[model samples]
Target: MIPLSPEILAALALALLAGLVAGAWPARRRLLAQAAEAARQAERAAQLQDRVAQLERDLSAQADALESWRARAQDGRLELAQLQAAHHEKLAAFEELRQAFDQSRATLRAEFQHLAGQVLEEKSQGFSRSSQDALGSLLRPFREQIESFQRRVNEIHDASVSGQARLDTEIRRVLETGLKMSDEAQSLAMALKGDKKATGNWGEVLLERSLQLAGLIAGDHYQAQASFRDEAGNRRQPDFIVRLPDGKHLIIDSKVSLVDYDRAVSAATPEAREAALVAHVRAVRQHIDDLARKDYSSLTGMKSPGFVLMYLPIEPAYIEAMRRDRELFDHGYRHNVVLVSHTTLMPVLRTVATLWMLARSNEQARALGDQAGGLYRQVEMVAARLQKLGHALGAAAAHYNGTVTAVAGQRGLYGKVGRFAELSAKAGRPLPALEPLLADFEVQRLDGIAPGADHVPETGRADAGSPPGAVPEDLHPPGEPNP
Candidate 1:
């Protein structure tokens, strides 16, 4: 037991209080550390949950991609099956056609052999030694004629080279201007982004001229420079709406892609060329995207299908760029844009016009054939009537000749040439009467038709049917009257 003095009791109680306080402080600190550890564990649990959620999301995306791949594989298998079936059907049909062709060929061969045998047997007697010699003589002369014809053909070919070159130069000159203007038209379209009357008029004129150069008329063949509204209420005006011969419309967006090409051509170094080429490729890709978004799918009134005809106003360089970098062009086709070069468009336009012309020509030929049939009938009737006409003509000619001779002997027409003719007769047998007619009859050189073509346009009658400004003296025979 402890002493119970006032001071010592107080001291002992104080010491006990100190010891208790110290123990309680250690217990409180341990409890606080445990609470902090629990908080750390809770945070780690939250992080693990987040990581699990992320992995699940990744797994879902992969599954979706796998499902898409399976769908594509199924579609491919179906296409392959259909292709195999079509191929088998085509092969069977081809075999049937082959059999039919064989039968027809055999029949033709049999008929030919039968005919040949019959002709050989029946004509065997007629084709004796004398006849064979005559045939040889005739064939020899025919070979000479064929040689002459071939020589004339060669001369004609040699003469035509100049004309072909001239025509090519003329055509290229005319078309080059249009190509230059097409470039300007592209510039004009870009300039049209700014609101201006000049831009508007320029756009219209550019489109109109392009249509005309493409051998089209606006009212008849196309509708030029039509405007459409975008979602932003801004007006979009395309350059050309080429109406094909079948009255179908193709929207043409002319883009100028030659700037980068020009730079590349003028580049002073390989590095420069490479830079310019890369820039040009990007520009072309951008152009494809721009031309693709021309509301072609919606405006053309087709969904999931549309043709965007991009008109590059340059030469084959633009087309070559696409060929060199196929990825850029693929960007275009992904959007259903077809990049058309000047050469391709020119032939396409020409073909379209030629087809139209052919259609008209066919119609004209049918009509002309009908008219020609009627003309043939009329000509046959005229041939009968011409017999009577010939009799009258002969009578009139004789009368005229007699009258001319009498009048000439009256010392009026023959007085001028009488002295000269009498002197010529004393010179050489009176210089035959036909010599004067032969001197005036000029055989026109058909130089315009290359060669081998005696296209003597109306040269038979020297007096009535000679070319303009032909010689007048002795155009008719000396016995024939000019009247």
Candidate 2:
């Protein structure tokens, strides 16, 4: 080969370098793509692992729930078994009771059939000669008794008939009298309706009667036609003034007009009645307003309530007024006027009376409490004095015991006697034997004195034949004294 030129060699080297660079780029790109694929596959595997873990956790929770449900089901099965067993036992008992009842019923039926057959046989046999005679003897008294009962029943029937006739006559008379009384009452009502003063008087009378029925006396509980001056110096006379326990007065006015109410009641046509009813309602409202304007609380020397009562003598008039005006009661209340009938006022008066009674009882109780307190103090003082007396008695008993012990000592009277005797013997002149005196002056102890021991000589006093404070001859140690 000829010697290669430098340019040719350089061109060949460049071609080789270009071809190597191109091949390396393809290999690097393939490696990068492989790495990216491997990363994606790893990420997918990690997500699948998380999903598997979540599924396992869910399965675990489901298994735990299934276990719990199984436990509950087992418990339910046990309870159902117990209930079924109890039901079986009850069924067995019921069957046994049914068999027993059937047996008893069959036995009763057989016995009844036998008895019925015997009765039929006896009935078919009819009465024998002796049985018939005996039966006739037995039935004779019954027959006589039945005859006497029949006679008594006939007498009672006759008497009842007469009495019924008399009762019917009396009933007719009573009916006639009732009708007459009703007519008279209607006439009186009409008369009352025509006269305003009379109507007021009637209402006052009814109020007084109601108060009396409620255990309230006229002068003691209430006053009639009591006049008082209002705040505007207007002299108003209420039908009645009831006194309460608190010194408060309830003013009651009974001069309400009833003419429209009477007209409403007697009206023939509905329109006329409605008109009269309206008029009645208007009259009542006017009366309520008038009474409210009176200002009864301003009465001098009397603690009157803010409200006044508008008294309606008749119950029918009151009912009609209320029926005509549905809001009449509310309206009256607003105006401080209370409308009341005889029937309604009775309870109010009774309540007032009860309040008074309670107040009186309270006063009595207070007085009794004060007296009891004083009595308790006196009792305490008495108890104190008794305690002091007991102490003084105890001290006296102690001093008496000490004196008794000193006087009854061994070296006391007996020792003195013995010394005196010795001195007498030394002087050649023995004193009369004092032993006899010592014997007569023996000491005795008593446990306690009997209740009626005044006749017995006291231990501190001289006996009939002994010295002072000496025991008697009949007295013995640890024994009862001779009577």
Candidate 3:
């Protein structure tokens, strides 16, 4: 135990030594690691403090800038709000003023139109009165002369009526005397026995006088042809054959259709009148058929040959008979046969004259159109010059408009301010606020200040003098207090 073997003694010493070294090594390593950790903590603390100080400075500067910006933003917001409110207020007032102006303008236009109508009415009445009075004065002598002629005509008509009655009575008496003696001569007039030359000649005299009054040569323009050849070369004598403008022949057979008139005069009772009317209708039908058989259109190869004017030198009573029979009249018209009585002959002649005039006028108008066309072409150069003049005038107007607008702008500014001063002077005191009650000192809304405004003049003309209401003082009302 005291002295061990060499290996045992060395092992024990080495063991002791190893034990001490191991314990000391662990203690030194622990101390060294603690010191390193402490140094790392100190370096970290320094870096963190520097970072915190930088962060504080940055936050302070940021806070100051944010406050400054907020103040400026608030100020800008206030100003923008004020401008918006003012714009809205101005727009509202302008709309109100515009509506008032439109109403006033409409009222003025209506009043002016009413006054113009009254003036025109009064003027028309005066003109009518003057015309009537002048016509009365001028026609006084003519009216008296007309009355005198009418009286003479009435007296003549009465005398003729009396004489005709006496003649009728004498003729009846003579017929009665003859019927009592010669049975063949019963109720037969001497004229009906072909003993009167005056009856046939009287018709020719009437024809000559009527034609003369109507401006026609009896034989040259129209005449009664006793003998005429038909299309088949058959010799036939019509009452009258008229030569057309183209030398074509037309037949004019004179016949009186007096069915209605005879019925009207001869009927003694209502039943008899009715019976006679029926007979007259049958007779008229027969007459229309007979007239239609006379193919007047075939009388000549004229284009409008079917149209024939059937002449009837008869009284109005006979004409009225045909007129009363609508079927007969329509039948005749449809057959292209225009029945012309003595009363209607003049109108027929006038129609023919108008037709001739129309043809002549048409030819004249065509000639005039071509002649005038050439004259219009000759002035084409002058027309182009006039068009150029019109263009130049438009350009000049544009330039003048620009100048007037510029002048009006400048003048309006100065005039409005000057007028404001003058109005206060005229009132002898400072002006009150421009409120709804005030009638003077119109605002921009009433004046229509905007460009392209409906109330503004399109292009103002130059004027040496000022326009109406240019001076506000002139339009200012007298206040309650004397000025």
Candidate 4:
């Protein structure tokens, strides 16, 4: 309850002052530190705001660039689609062209073959007619000679029939003339018999006449006096070497021995005639043996058959030889010698001529086939060129379509340009209009290409009236007369 001492009061005032001073200093320091922290925080907030603004601008620029890229991508897609469509169209056109070319080649080949066959047939017919005319001319003289001989015989017979004395003298004169003619004939026969060259020539003339009637030519179907060398280097000449279409040669030899035949006919007695006939048979057998020994089949450069032909010039002589010795024919066959007369030889020669004609026809056909092969090769070359052209066209179309698709697709060049303009406008900076891209192109289709329109004429169609697979009548040769 007592009043405070003066020293205590003074001490308390000082302590109070000290405490107030100390408290003020701490508050002021705390307030200054808070102020400094607030200043640093405000500076950091300002920097963060600036950084956020920069990020916003960068994000906006990135968005614009992305839009532009997207537009370019759309353009690429559009170009690709267009290219695909163009490629498809080009491929279709190429296929059509190839088909047309093939059809045209085939049609041309058929026409060529048909024309060739017609031409060959015409030539064959003309040749045949000419040959027949020549053969007829050759036989006319022989026919006239026979008619004259018959008329002479009839006149002689008429003279003999008259019974008056004057007519008897006329008959005797006719008889003497007949005897002179007979003697002349005997002399000619004897000359032919004596001269080997004349005998061979006579036989050859007969053979030639027979062959002509048989439609065979000397050099074309048969060679006269054709010489060949044997394996032993011995050269021999055959009277006639008949050529076969199958590359075979028929050797023919004509040797007529009329001496024995004339002796037999003019023999004084039956025993002499028999001996003469026997001698004639022996001569014929010897000739056959000689022909066999020639071995014509072994001749070089000649495809001679195993048998040789023993041609008898006269039909009467052939008959007499056969009748006198029946075994002569068999012996000739055994010796590989076939005895043939003018009548028999005609048939053989005609066969050979027919074979030659057939061979000629075959050769013509082979030539035609070769021509066709050449034509086919040419067609193939043309086709290859067409194929290459088509391939190039198809590739071009594909590239063009791709370009169109790229230009028209979303995010393509046009799209990117539009987007950029829009972005510029939004930013209050409009861009100028870009140049317009090319409009989509429409490919035109190929037309007017058809098969066989280039080489073959349109009028070359087969006859409507003709039956299926019917050949033209001109393809066949004219009918020839039978030998």
39-131: candidate 1 lDDT, tens digit per residue: 999999998997797679657755754564355446534543553464355334434333333343344335434433443354234456785
* Residue 60 displacement (Å), model 3: 99
- Model 3 has an lDDT value of 0.44
Q: Write the residue-wise lDDT of candidate 4 on 268-319 in tens digits.
A: 8657877886887787788888888887777778787688989876544565
| Model 3 C-alpha lDDT per residue in residues 165-268, reported as the tens digit of each score | 54335333422332232222211222233333442343344434444433344575566645545688866555555444555554555543434435544557
Top candidate by TM-score? 2
Better of 2 and 4 by TM-score: 2
- Name the lDDT of candidate 1: 0.50
lDDT of prediction 2: 0.57
- Cα lDDT of model 2 by residue, 1-483, tens digit: 799899999999999999999989989999999999999999999989977976796577557545643554465345435534643553344344333333433443354344334433433244367854664464354345434433533443354345334433532343234224334433556676568777777666666766775667788889997777767777877778999988889888888877887787688865787798799899899988877777665678767768888887665567567755889999999988888865456546656765765565445334333432333233233233333433444465566556555555565554556567665656565434322111111011111211122343332233455322222322222343321
Question: Using Cα atoms with residue i matched to residue i, what is each candidate's TM-score against the true structure?
Answer: 0.34, 0.47, 0.29, 0.46
Q: Which residue window of length 10 is worst by lDDT in model 3? A: 468-477
Pairwise lDDT winner, candidates 2 and 3: 2
Residue runs of model 2 more than 4 Å from their true location after superposition: 1-187, 409-418, 421-483
Q: How close is candidate 4 to the true structure, as a TM-score?
A: 0.46
Would you list the C-alpha lDDT of every candidate in the order shown? 0.50, 0.57, 0.44, 0.56
Off by over 4 Å in 3: 1-209, 231-233, 244-251, 257-267, 270-281, 300-304, 353-483
Where does candidate 4 stray beyond 4 Å? 1-196, 228-235, 262-278, 417-483
- Residue 41's lDDT within candidate 2 is 100
Report clashes for each candidate as comma-separated counts: 1, 0, 0, 21
